[model samples]
Target: MAFPRVSILPLLLLLLITPFSSSLSLSDTITKDSLYQLCSQPTIRKHFCIIWLTNDPTTFTLNFYGLLGLVIQKTQLYGYKNLAMMKSLVRTTTDPMLKIPYGSCVTYYESAIKSMEEAIKFAILKKYELTSEAAGKAFSSINSCEADLAGRNTVPSDVPLRNIRFKRMCNIVRVFSDVLTAKNY
Candidate 1:
């Protein structure tokens, strides 16, 4: 009985690709888990970190820089939303004192949003130090707004609490930026 000849080229190619493919998949799993672990580090809201980081399908493939960009964008969106809410409150409020605080809160949110935008731009430019600084500014603005409201005991209902949560998210981003810069990741 005679057997048909099998091309050695196909077998050789399979042998060459198998290890690389397996390693690639293994690396992906490792990255995903490690990224999740990293998110849990500084943020008090572990669930929020996990959900926010994992909600986007593209997040699993993102490096630290890309994750920082995503955080900046989300924080900016939160700031804008809070700004609009403050504006609405200011418009509808009857108390002059409330108007002053609301107006100030609006300005703070706007400033935070701007800083977040700057952070995103810096991240895109691969300037991690600038990105981290901008993010810190954004975080400070959020905290300032919350502090101002709290000092006066006139927080816009849930705005202070929301700001605290947003600050935590920004904190996570900022910490990652610092770590990545320090370690040259």
Candidate 2:
């Protein structure tokens, strides 16, 4: 007895489509719940992590290392912005006192940018410990800039706010890198 032609076509189509559909679903496995779980790590700021990741449409399709790379890029951009702002201030300020802090901030931001570059390299290599360490160094650079500016009588209002946001980015990178490291071990 032979199977009908119509029945054989349906079976063949199902077999062909099943693998493609399942692979697509697997790529989309980073749901809200999973994001919540990732952000819930003790050192991570859950709200910031959730908001940042959710805002980026690409986050849903990326794995953990890819997410880390995204965060690193954002942090690097922040560092560059801060560096440029400080450089501008240093050059334009007439007051020698203001220039001192602004110059210090320029150095700090440069260091932060360097550290973030290192983080990106280590992240690409899947060296989670070095990635976390580089992020920590970047965080420390931001904190140092903040503290240096705090002591000055005159400072830009936006500097403090930028410092806060930049620190948050660094925290996310550090925590994510740490989580990845722990999972590997």
Candidate 3:
């Protein structure tokens, strides 16, 4: 005796479409992972640097304050006695290449977590103010991205991962430039 055939159309469709899923695609063209992979390829870094300098033509300006905060919080995170003793954010250049020793990664990680959380809030709010769908998606994605960044096993900024961080950095600067330049600033 043979068993009756059952309708498996839905399962077949799902399986057929699984290979073409849009789960990882970005809005326009490529995923952030693809972009980062492109960024990581040999000569792509040079191309990115060239494009960054030519297009936006600015340093990581928003992080300027955050870098200052990190410098100021050095002693708190490091248990050193002279971090806040500096004259100002700009004056703390005594050691241009001092590296934090081992055993303090977690402390710096926590400090960065707190600081980056605030920056994400600020950036998200700014994006919300733009009143555009693109901005909203970008900002929402940023919230998730930053959350992932904070959840890393190591300090996010130094983590050797491939993702949207570089692209988003360039986007922030480029978009901000577009805003300022459009407004005659």
Clash-forming residue pairs, model 3: none
Cα lDDT of model 3 by residue, 29-125, tens digit: 3333433332332323445533433343232232322322222232123212111221121143333321221213323333433443444454345
TM-score of each: 0.75, 0.80, 0.22
Residue 167 Cα positional deviation in candidate 3, in Å, after optimal superposition: 13
How well does candidate 3 score on lDDT at residue 52? 38
Give the clash count for each candidate: 0, 0, 0
Task: Point out where model 2 deviates above 4 Å.
Answer: 1-29
The per-model lDDT (C-alpha) reads 0.72, 0.82, 0.34
Q: Give candidate 1's error at residue 184 in angstroms.
A: 2.1
Per-residue lDDT of model 1, residues 102-133, tens digit only: 88888888888888888888878877788889
Off by over 4 Å in 3: 1-100, 127-185
Q: Which candidate gets the maximum TM-score versus the true structure?
A: 2
Per-residue lDDT of model 2, residues 8-110, tens digit only? 7887687556532232222234777667777877877789889988998888878666777888998899789878888999999877888888888898999
Q: What is the C-alpha RMSD of each candidate to the true structure, in Å?
A: 9.0, 9.2, 17.1
* Alpha-carbon runs more than 4 Å astray in model 1: 1-32, 43-45, 151-156
